[model samples]
Target chain A: MSIKKVLTGNHAVSYGAMASRVQVISAYPITPQTQVVELLSELVADGKLDAIFVNVESEHSAMSACISASAAGARAFTATSAQGLALMHEMLHWAAGARLPIVLADINRAMAPPWTIWTDQNDSLSQRDTGWMQIYVESNQEAFDSIILAYKVAEQVFLPCMVVLDAFVLSHTSEPIEIHDQEKIDEYLPPYRPMVTIEPGKPIGYGALAAPDTYMEFRYKMQRAMENAVEIFEKEGKLFGDMFGHSYDLVEPYMMDDAEYVIITVGAVTSTARVAIQELRKKGEKAGLLKFRVLRPFPFEKLRELLSGRKKVAVIDRNISFGHHGIFYQEVKSALYPLSNRPPVFGYIAGLGGRDITVSDVVDIYEDMKKRETLEEIIWKGVKL
Target chain B: MVEIRTHGRGGQGAVVASKILADAAFRVGKYAQSFPQFGVERRGAPVVAFTRIAESEEELPVRSNIYEPDHIVVLDPTLLSIPDTFAGLKEGGWVIVNTPELPENLDIPAKFRVATVDASEIAVKYGLGSKAQPIVNTAILGAFSRVLENVIPLSAILNSIPEEVPVKPDANQKACEEAYNMTRIRK
Candidate 1:
């Protein structure tokens, strides 16, 4: 029987890990994401969960434990945010290249400048080139479902996956999430069988230093593995949908079919953008939203299809690349550059430094989209005007 | 729709309280969303979490930080002396505080409904120890269950606690029951 439970994004992540039957958990406490480890620690301590909880000294150590655990033929999990993720930058490349298939829940927080501990998308987006698949969540329920899907996809491709949620915005926010039965989850996702296993009986070398002769080949193999993930991602997602009631095609769309204009966003911003569209449509505006739930692997093919017929598009990014356009807009524009039927695209960067973005701000963007607006590179919206 | 906000330190169960409140509300068939506003996620630091309970779909562009909470549960009464604690409570809204000594001399806004309970005392009496977590949330939920009659039933909440706590089940159940009884409706 399904039971309704109010859970934060953090708790949902832990619950997902529990449902995934995670064999090992390695984590160090970090703000915004600390409660995630805290709850998991409580579960492990109380013997409610049978997983091994490895208490590491730092984020780097935490990631290391996960890597080791995964290499030892276990379903490993860990979580971190902000600088903690930054600290694991080198090992992130290690985990992906080694093909350990570890799942990480990254509570997206802003990197230090004025030394702030607030919610932003830069932390996870900055790790885009590390050969890890990234998934953004709009709600706690999505956070719960994303981690389960993440584990399945990661194991299928033997690559690491990161499920990103806004730190304070979604991480600590509570929402009603339906908890699935263990038997059903087990039926939906079977036990992880490693394509590789390292034990004393079969000793194997991992992450051996490569010379110029094999370095490019190793990197190429990693690229091919990521490409493989794209297909497996679809298969696993379809399977998840067949069993569960909710499903999305890597990227989730809201009223985008046969639309004159579209606004693009990621994470929780998509929820607000949908609300804005509803308000605008009431006034007879032909507007819709293309929410990018999966940031990594770019979903370039889907972007091409969604933007091909639209007249105008605006990409809203929570992270600024500093001195250049918003990162997401650059990706969107480049993805559509080859197509002849591409729409006029605009980029808007707003809500940095944990400044909350409101629905009226979204309505304002849709109004501008209706006007078919343009700027040089990226325009900053909602500036106390 | 009724919005509830909980104020406490980082280590406290403010966020958990918000979740339990939302869960209880949902158990009774109300739509709810609970979220926290945190800057420093360090222990003992002040933290704020919010919940929105409605009878219909919850739609908004900008999710506000509970500018006008229908009810405010103060896990730490000392926070009253701190700045910006009770800034935006709606007039006629209820404030439940966890302190033995109510601020009799303190000026309360007219039309405010105020109630006081020694939540820590009840927690200690129930062997919740100095780590005032988990229980405070339950006690507050029990008190709230009584106050907001239609929101949730107290029995539903007791049934939700995991079965692993076999030894202290009676204490927790009693603490919640006592808190439900101890709640004094505002005159």
Candidate 2:
């Protein structure tokens, strides 16, 4: 039986990690992400979760510790936010290149020079090239379930997974979610049994030195594992749905079957866009939403399949790639580029530094997409200037 | 769906009050969500929190701050001086304020229903917080349940107090009940 509880997105991640029976948690406290590890530490101290809660000095050390723990054959986990995530940049590469299946919950906080602690996608989107499979979630429930699913898929592919949630919007927001029973979760996700581990007295070397003769092979294998993860994610997602009744996918399409104009979104913005789509549909506008759940592995084929003949496509990105289009906008346009009859993909940047994107704003974007005959470099929404 | 926004200073349990309202709503089999907007982490600074209750999860799909609220709860009466306090409030909405003065004495617009309770005095009477800054959140919520009875029941708020307020749960509950009885409304 599943239990329902009102939980903050941060606490949901904590409960999810605990239910997954994570053996090692090493994370430093960061705004909008601290509550995640705070609850985990208490659970470990109270004996509810039998795990080692390592106290790390910084985000870099946090990821480093997770790397060491996973190397020693433990189900490792950590949580961090914008600057902390940025600090873990080098170690993120290290964890992925070493083929340790570590799971991280990155509360999406905007990178600071102005020093703000608000929700944005730039933080996690900046790490797109670090070889970590990133899954941006829409709600607190998905944030919790993704932890277990992340581990199931990551361990199989030997690549790290980053479960991303909007800071404050989801991180601090409280919502009622169905908490799965431990036994059922355990049945769904078996123990992480890595093919290699650093055992005592075994004296096996790891990450020694890959010469040019073999350096390319490791990259090739990692690429193959990533490719393999696409199928594994689909299978595990379906199986999780069969067990828990909530199914997930690389992309979730809403009202898109006959949608003439489609709006693409990621993270919490998808929820707002969903409301916009419903309102638009009621008004006789065939608007639709395609929510991107899995950022990594790109799902280019799925994008092409879903968006091939749409009249117009609008991609709302909370993160901007300076001097260029929105990050997701670039990805969507690139994905549809190969199609001979692909509709025009409009790029929009909105809700950066934690601005609230209202449903009406989304409707405006749909209207803007309809009026535009050519692509603009970037369509700025909700900008004061 | 009913949307509520709470205004208070830091250390006044505004955020906790939002969560407790959501928890109370959840206890009664409603889909609820609560969150806060914090400018800074210092006491005496203004803070705002939001609670949303709906018949089902699908009714609460917009994951953004509540702009237009059906009701507003003022834990600190001084917050009323700020224009943002009553911004975008719907006509005929409830304005539940924690003040000793009756609803007629308050300076709010007449279009909205006003309910006033001396929550600060009641909270101190129960020794919930310091006399200087008594935690009036529970009392305000108690008044909320009474004035907005159709939205949430007092019994549900009473049941949720212990679960949400770990320290001096009895005191908070007593303050809540007292404010519920003492609240004066101008419909």
Candidate 3:
């Protein structure tokens, strides 16, 4: 049964970890991401959940703790954001390469130099090549649900999973979420029975340096696992939907049924886009919103499938690839490139550094997309031109 | 849909009040969402939280942060000095405020409806917290129910405050009821 509680995305992540009955949580405190572990700490302290809370000193130590704990036959969880994620880069590769199914909630904060603590997808997008499955969520409820799903999907694929939500935007925003009961969640994500575990009698070398002869095979296997997850995630999402009555799709196409023109975005910004698309529809514009819920396993096929027939698409991203273009914009373009009859994809970078992506901005993006020729790319919406 | 913004300092219950109001509305057969303005997370710093009450389940303006709020609740009267507290509030928005006694020089627009309650005094009377800091969030929520067009029932708020406050449900309930009776409204 589901009981309603208003929670921030951080608190929802905490409840998700608790619902899965996570055995071990090793996390270092970071802005936006700190409260996820903080609430877990209280849960553990209050005796509501039995778990070991490892207060690691750094993000590297945190990931290392999770990796080792998962290897030791425990359901391990951790979270990070922005620079904290950057610091965990080395251990991230290790977690994926060693194939430990550690779950992390990366609250997508903008990276620093100008010392910003705002929402952006840059930090997570930069790690796209890493083997961790990335799941982007739009609401506090989905943030909670995705962590549970991440554990299931990651464990199945023997790959780590990153549940990403916009920092501050979703992380700090409170909304009503149906907190599922423990027994129900237990049925959803049963206790981890590690495929391989470290024991007293069994002597095994783990994460040992592979020779050039074997390294490529291991990399190939990781790619194969990622490919397998694409289908597994879709299947598990359907199963979850059946169980919980909340449908999850890799590419959540909102009001796209009759849309000739669509805006493709992810995370919290998609919520604004939905409102904007509906407003446009009121004025008889064939506008729609296609939001990516599962970013890793790329959902390239799904995007291509949904977008192939559309006349035009505006790809809005909160993170940019510096010299290239918006990260999601680039990904969107790539997904459509192989199709001969693809829409003219317009690239846009907006809401970086936690700037608000308002309904008006979505309307403007749609208006801009209508006026743009194929040559007019990289719209950079909201930047002072 | 009714959009609301709540302003308070760190440690006051502005955020919790907004969330409780949303939940109370939801319990009374409405769709509601409450979220905080993300800024510096230090206590004693100014804080803002938003709530949206929609009659339809699918009509929630989730992605758009409340720009022109239909109502504004000031958990701390001191925040009235900050222009940001009233920023984006339209001319005719409802303003519910917490104060020991109503003060003049509140720079709110003339067209707006104003309501004042001694929520802090009620918090102190109920022994909600230390004398210096009374958790008046629940009390002002009582004021909110009265100031608004009774869209949220006081009974629903009574049932909802305990779920939110957690620490002192009885005190919060009592405070909510007293503030509900005492709120002075000026249209």
Candidate 4:
């Protein structure tokens, strides 16, 4: 039997890491994400978790410690928010390039100049090309489940994974979730066994300078590993569901069986959209929602198949690409570009800097999508000009 | 579905009170969700928290902040003067306050039922906090259980205190029980 507890999203992440039996944890304190490491440290100190809790002065050092730990054949984990994530930018690429399957929980906080501790996707979106697999979660339960899944998938594909959730929204929100039996989790996720490790007296250079002759091949191998992750994620997800009864995929489709109008969303916004779609259905509107769970290893074929032949589609992005359109908007349009029957994908930028996206606001977007004759390049919602 | 908005000062356990309510609701086999106002909190500054309870998880899927709450809990009586404290409260809802004054004498609209308790005195008597700034969150929740008895039982609230109230579990439970018995309601 699974243990049930009311946990904040941050604590849920900690429990996820603990359940995975992470061998090493190193982190710096940051808003919204602080409670995550705080709980982990307490667990470690209280002897609940037998792991090395490395106290670091900076996020860069924190990631560095995780990289070193994972390189030495240990399961390593860390959690951080906006600026802290940005500070660890260089080391993020290093971890991925080294093919260490370290799991990092990034609470999505907006990049700040005005100094705000609110939710937004800009911080994580900016790290799109770092070669780390990103999974955005909707609920606190998913936040916990995804971490275990991340380690399972990452360890197999030899790629680092970042489990992302909305700052404050998911991070601070408390909800009921099932904490799976440790023996069951252990049965699913065995101890981490690396093919090679930095052992004493075994002189092997790590991340050595790749000459021009072999640099392209290393990049090619990384790309191949990413391609392999797509299938690995599916297989592990199915296996996990068979064991624990909560299966997940790259994307979650809601009310899309015969939906002519679809809304594409990511992260916590999908929860609100689910409610809005139910309300829309009650009023006899054929509205559906497809939540993008995985950002990296973009589900191109999946998007094309789900969005093909739709009358109209709207992509709601909480993160902007500044000069261009919303980040997910660009990805969706790109995915549908090759489809023979591509729908008009409208881009909407909404709920930046922790602005609440109410059910009414979502319904309004659907109404706006239906009323428009021609598609606008970008539509701004809930923004004061 | 029952939505509750809690108003309190920063130093007060407003967020913890919200969590405790959610935990109590969950103890009775109900789905619960709670969160605080997404802002930097400063001591003595006004803070708000929300708790949502429903029969199923689907009913509480919407993650946005609570706009129109079914009821309101005020931890600090001074916060009652702030218009935003009652901004989106539903009509004919319960207004549970922590004040020494009687519910009938308190300045609240007659449309809503008011329940008042001297939670400060109860908390202080139990030594939950200090004489000047007593941590009245547990006591207020006790009064909440009394006023909204049908929503969540007093036993669940009493049972949830030991796990949630970290500082002084026994004292907090006693304060809650006292406030539950001492609460005065003007309906």
TM-score winner between candidates 1 and 3: 3
Alpha carbon lDDT of residue B19, candidate 3? 78
Candidate 1, residue A64: the lDDT equals: 94
Candidate 3 lDDT over A1-385, as tens digits, reads 6798767789999999988889999999989898899999999999988999998889999999998899998999999999999989999999999999999999999998888888998899888888888999998899999999999999998999999999977887767789977777889898887889977799888998899999999999999999989999999899999888886878999888889999988999888888898899999999989987887888878888899989899989889988899888888888889999999988888999988899999999999898876655677788877
Interface RMSD of each: 2.3, 0.8, 1.7, 0.6
**Which CAPRI level is candidate 3?**
medium
Residue A252's lDDT within candidate 3 is 90
TM-scores, all candidates, are 0.85, 0.99, 0.95, 0.99
The chain B TM-scores of all candidates, as shown, are: 0.82, 0.98, 0.93, 0.97
Using DockQ, rank the candidates from best to worst.
Answer: 4, 2, 3, 1
- Given candidate 2, what's the lDDT at residue A141? 97
Off by over 4 Å in 3: B42-44, B81-83, B100-108, B128-134
lDDT of each residue in A112-194, candidate 1, tens digit only: 97788887888998899999999998888889988889988888778899999987778877677887777888887788898
- Model 4 chain A TM-score equals 0.99
Question: Model 3, residue A372: what's the lDDT?
Answer: 77
lDDT measured at residue A238 in model 3 versus the true structure, 0 to 100: 93
TM-score of chain B of 1: 0.82
DockQ of 2: 0.88
Q: Whole-model Cα lDDT per candidate?
A: 0.80, 0.93, 0.87, 0.93
List model 1 lDDT by residue over B78-182, tens digit each: 787865777878888777776676535345565777776667778777776465453466566667667766666787656544332344667767877787788
Residue A102, model 4, lDDT:
97
The 10-residue segment of model 2 chain B with minimum total lDDT is B37-46
Alpha carbon lDDT at A79, candidate 1: 97
DockQ of each candidate, alpha-carbon based: 0.45, 0.88, 0.60, 0.90
What TM value does model 1 have? Answer: 0.85
